[model samples]
Target: MDVSKVRKDFHILEKRVRGKPIIYFDSACMALKPKQVIDAVNSYYNDFTACHGRSVHYFSAQTTEKYIEAHRKVERFIGAKENEVVFTKNCTEAINLVANGLKWEKGDRVITTKMEHNSNLIPWMKLAKERGVVHDYVEVDNEGKLDIEDLNAKLETKTKLVSLVYTSNVTGATLNASEVAKICHDAGAMLLLDGAQAVPHMKVDVKKTGVDFLAFSGHKMLGPSGTGALYGRLDLLKGMNQFIVGGETVKNTMLSSWEAEDSPAKFEAGLQDYAGMLGFGAAADYLMRLGMEEVHSYEKKLARKLYDGLKAIPQVTNIYGPSNPEERSALASFTLKGMNPQEVALILDESANIFVRSGMHCCHLYHQDVIHEMHGTIRPSLYIYNTDEELDKFFDALRNIAALA
Candidate 1:
């Protein structure tokens, strides 16, 4: 990939702070948007601003067409049918849709990993509290990789679902989805992958992985916020209960009764974010044109460089995840020996115009129980738009920071 050309696509890269060019290393939180996505969002508001699938006016018709097309684009991106894609506000809502909508019997078991984000973990915990559902967490190794043996040991005949993160937001460790899916299916359970970190960095084929359900956010993939999707098997979705009721989710309603719409529409209640959907579709198109394999290869190369550079620093300690680039995404979470994570992040921003995440990254269980880091680690996440020069600048800043340590 042409690094300089890719940087040009994101206008945010031109931004300056503290008399220096901004070095954004927080893509895991939210990616920087490209001009193409921005234009697509603007076109929706400028050319066609009307409610979708509710009226017969020209604006409504055009808006609905774009909205439906966006669904198809996302479907193609994730290897799912158009009807299988249900738009949600974000990944959190997508996960909740499955957690709440699924028919959970008393004492039914759900398996998850210890390293999952709060969005993935809290819903199941809530279910266990409200209903008689059983929630179990698989163990993670020191490197933050999920223990397959522990996962298998946790699985039982009563296991209803095995929901896990495709990639760790805290450690950037990528999971073997196909292997996990096979384990779940062999144990007579369904697999649901939280793909918020994986989908943006690598190619994810639901069919190949044989996942029963998948959830991801568009904002982390160069799209607008308040846009995400859930992909569920058609048969499962048809049988599952509706999450939110009212409005476009239903086809017809009487005083005493109501009939819900088909699969995708049944899950999507009320007015949708038409502009955000268009921008998400455009973002998917942009990534497809570049090719996911190429994107993955480029990111791995950058990640390797980042890991090697950080390891060479004497003050840097306890770099999380696998050392191998192919086993992880383009991110490195670590800590300086004596400095607080938040303090280091603030210094980087104020002195070097660098933006990095510092905290537990919402995986409180992993931080509190697994790693036992009370403060947290400094996380520098990368994307296609990030360049080597930016990494060099980061290394320079780190070396100076190390002197203090």
Candidate 2:
């Protein structure tokens, strides 16, 4: 792949910030949109801006077609069936849809790991507390990788669901979903993955993993914000209750009697973000054209380079996952000794024109167990758009910051 040509597709990379070129390394939080995705969204608004699934008029039909086509794109991207994918506001909402929609009874157990983001953690935690269900956490080693032995031990007879983050947003630790799913199935528990950080940077085969459900956001995958999906097995979706019920989710209604729609449409309860959904389709197509294999390889090279460089700096404190780059995503989280992560991030932004994320990254419980300071870790997440040259600049800035310390 032509690196320069790929960079040109993102118009944001062409601009300068504070008279210096912007070096964005926060793609894990949200990826910069490409021109193709932008154009797709723009065209939707310009041509058809009507209510979907409501009317039989031309614009409404076009809107409905585009919205349903986006569902197909999401299904293809994640190796799920069209009826299995349910659109949500973001990954948080998608996770919540599963966590809350499921039939939870007293003595039921839900297992997750300490490495999970709050999106995956809090929803289950709330369910455990409110529904009198038991929640167990499979603790990770200091290296930020899950202890499979501990996980297996926790899979007791009562284990009802096993939620996991396929890739950590903080440490970039990638989990083996296939193995995890097998273990969960052996215990007769359903496996639901938080793919918010994994889907964009890695290749995901939900069928091969044998997971029963999965959720991911499109903003992190180069699409517009406020768009995400939840993939649930057809039978499971059929069994679960619809959390949100309104206009588009009902099949037929009377004053006191109403029938629910089919699997996905029943779950999607409101007038949807049609433009954003279509743009998500374009984003999926964009990544598919670039090839997920190439994206993974390119990102691994950059991750290892960043890891090695950070290790050489004495004042920089690195918190990484597995030792192998092939086992992780391009993102990394670290902190400068004696410096607040937010303070360091501010200095880098003001002095070096580099953008990075700082603080708990909404994974406070995980960081509280790992780092001394409970607030969070400074996260520098890389992506296909970021080049090695920008990473070098980041290293130079860190080195200079170390001198100040």
Best by lDDT: 1
Q: For residues 17-120, could you state the per-residue lDDT of candidate 1 as single tens digits?
A: 76668999999999999999999999998998999988999999999999999999999999997699999989999999999999999999999988999999
Question: What do the candidate models score in CA lDDT, each in turn?
Answer: 0.92, 0.88
Off by over 4 Å in 1: none
Question: Which window of ten consecutive residues has the lowest lDDT sum in model 1?
Answer: 11-20
Per-residue accuracy of model 2 over 1-405 as CA lDDT, tens digit each: 567899999999989987878999888888999999999899789998999989999999999988889889888988887688998889999999998789888999998887789999899889878889998999787767878999899999899999988888987887889998998899899999999998998788889888999999999999999999999999999999889898899999999978999989999988988889999999999998998889889998899888888888888776567777667668788888888889899899999989999998888887887655575788899888988898999999999887887
Where model 2 places Cα greater than 4 Å from the true spot, the runs are: none
Task: Report the Cα lDDT for candidate 2.
Answer: 0.88
RMSD vs true structure, all candidates: 0.8, 1.1
Q: How many angstroms is residue 405 displaced in model 2 relative to the true structure, after the best TM-score fit?
A: 0.8
